[model samples]
Target: MALFVETGLKPLSANESYLGKKTKSKAYRMYENHLLRVLPDLPLEPKGKMKLTAEVYYSNKLSDLDNALKPFIDCLQKRYLFNDNRIYKLEVEKFIVEKGAETILFRLDPYSQEGDKDYVPHPTDDREHRCPECGHSF
Candidate 1:
C-alpha cells in the first residue's frame, strides 16, 4: 500500500473535517488528474508514445512533465507522437541504406590528410564514396 492508504485514507464524513482538513489534498488530486488528461496533446510531448512515457515519467504531475518536455520538443522540432513506429524504423533503414558500406568514421584520423605520418588506414567496401577521402561519411 502507498503512504496515502498506509496513513489510512478515509472520508472525513463531516462538513467541518472535509472543509478544513481534506481540502488541499482533494484539490491537488483533482489538478493532477486534469493534467494527465491534458498533457499528451500538448506541444511539449515527445514524438512517440513510448518516448513520451519514457521522457515524461519523471514528473509526479502531468503538467510538470509537459513543462519538462518543452526544451526537448524545441530541440527535436516538435516531432511528437508518430502515428506509426514503422516509419521511425524506415528512417533508420534509409540512413543505413544510403550510407551503405561506408568506412566507419572512428577508424579515420580527422587532422590527417593523404601523406601525413599520423594518417590512419580506413577500410573501404564497394560503395561509392560520397564522403571525404579521409573517411566515408554521410
Candidate 2:
C-alpha cells in the first residue's frame, strides 16, 4: 500500500519562472523529472495560481518514511534560492493519503480569511473547522 505526502508551500517572493505555469496550473515537470521520480504519477492542479501561494505535491507510501520529507525539502532550499540562501516559506499545507487514488481534496483559502473555510475536524488545523457558512464536514 502506498501513501502520499503532499505539502503545499507558498513561494517566498517573486520567484516565478522557477515555478512553471502552463495555464492556471503549476507545471510539475520539474517536480516529476527531478524530486519525486519514485512516484511519477503525482497529481497537480490546473494551470493557475495556487490558492494562497505556490505549492507542489509529492507522495510516499511508508508511514514512518512518510515524515522523512523534511530533508528532502532541505535540498530544494539549498539548490534553489539564488540569493544568500534564505529559505522563503516552507510549511505543511496539508497532509493526506488517498486510499482509492480518486479525488484529491485539500482545504484552500480562495478568499484567504482567517475564519472562513474548511472541512477537517482537527482543532489544530490552521483554517476554520466548519464551512464558515454552509457548515459542511468530511
> Best TM-score goes to which candidate?
2
For model 2, what is the alpha-carbon lDDT of residue 99?
A: 56
- The pairs that clash in candidate 2 are 3-60, 3-61, 23-47, 24-46, 24-47, 24-48, 25-46, 25-47, 25-48
Task: Give the lowest summed-lDDT range of ten residues in model 1.
Answer: 86-95
Off by over 4 Å in 2: 1-33, 36-69, 78-85, 99-138
The Cα error of candidate 1 at residue 88, in Å, is 15
Q: What TM-score does prediction 1 earn?
A: 0.16
Residue by residue across 1-138, what tens digits does model 1's lDDT show?
222212123445335544454433575556445544544443432332222222232312323433433333332332333332212111000112222342111110112135445434554458553434445342
Distance (Å) between predicted and true CA of 104, model 2? Answer: 12
Q: Which stretches of candidate 1 lie over 4 Å from their true place?
A: 1-54, 59-63, 78-138
Residue 30 in candidate 1 has what lDDT? 64
Please provide, for model 2 over 18-135, each residue's C-alpha lDDT reduced to its tens digit, 9 standing for 90 to 100.
5675332243445434544342332333232223232224354434432434334433333432222232222343333565542223222223234434423323446534444555
RMSD of 2: 16.3
TM-score against native, each model: 0.16, 0.23
RMSD (Cα, Å) of model 1: 25.8
